[model samples]
Target: MNNDERIHLLAKELIPLYDDLAADTRLVVEEHARTCKICNEELRRFNATFAPLAAKEEVEPNAEIKPFKKLQAFKALMVGLLFLARFLLIGLLVAAFDPAAPRLLGGNIIMFYFPLAAASLSILYFFYRKLWFWVLVLFDVFILFFLDEVIYYLLL
Candidate 1:
């Protein structure tokens, strides 16, 4: 077959792969499209729709939440904004929480680790250079674990 015919055939076969696609799959689809015009045109449309999405700038919620359903969103937003604006002041926050808070009043420090882990992962994702992230994580873990062991020893 001529180049246009070959591309058309390939595109007809491969266009469905566009839904969940990647570079390797695209390359394979393109290989067949190179010899067919019809397939090439379809590939162009598929790439237009799928490529930008695969580039992944951000993740939107799958569906919109209703107003009442968004109460948690507002609570989360306030907590996130405050936590971000004054991250360094978190040590002070520990002391400032209501004394009647069961988790805090009980001296159960495990409750604190969840926020710490989230903060740690946020820093890693923002600073996505893998080596520096791993080094910082290891260093933080070492320090925290050592501090915990020391505290445990002292308490014993």
Candidate 2:
């Protein structure tokens, strides 16, 4: 073959390394590289360029996983606390529903209602973390106390 024809054949063989050639084209290229010194040299140069990238050290993330595990543990604890608070609120409400419950220091059942309302508000505040809910709870407590005082004055 002439020099131009030989160069053309070498270029065709190198096409598989640079681009995704057909399977038959890749087989033909590999066959030519096995016999042609020029094509073999080109293939070696191309493979050498990628050799460093393929031989890099892989790093293990053993130390970084500890913090992630700690975060998961804290998340589980918060969920447990939230469920506990909900159950306590439900138990308190059920106890208050009993007709035989004793009176507090003032002999007024209204006195106990304030602490129940406060506990419910605190639970809501802890779970939601919203300033608006806290503000509304405070406003409700104020209104409740004001209404209770007015009714007491009317009864007396």
* RMSD in Å for all candidates: 14.0, 12.5
- Computed on alpha carbons, the lDDT of every model, listed in order, comes to 0.58, 0.56
lDDT of 2 by residue, 1-156 (tens): 897577557666565455356687666666777777777777677768765655564447464534577766775686566546545644464344433332221234355445655665665576556764566577555645464344345443
Q: For candidate 1, what is the lDDT?
A: 0.58
Per-prediction TM-score to the true structure, in the order listed: 0.29, 0.29
Off by over 4 Å in 2: 1-31, 34-42, 55-71, 100-156
Best model per lDDT? 1
Q: What is candidate 2's local distance difference test score? A: 0.56
Residue 7's lDDT in candidate 2 = 55
Q: Mark the 10 consecutive residues where model 1 has the least summed lDDT.
A: 101-110
Candidate 1, residues 50-105: lDDT per residue as tens digits? Answer: 77987785557686745665765765575466446444434444445453443342
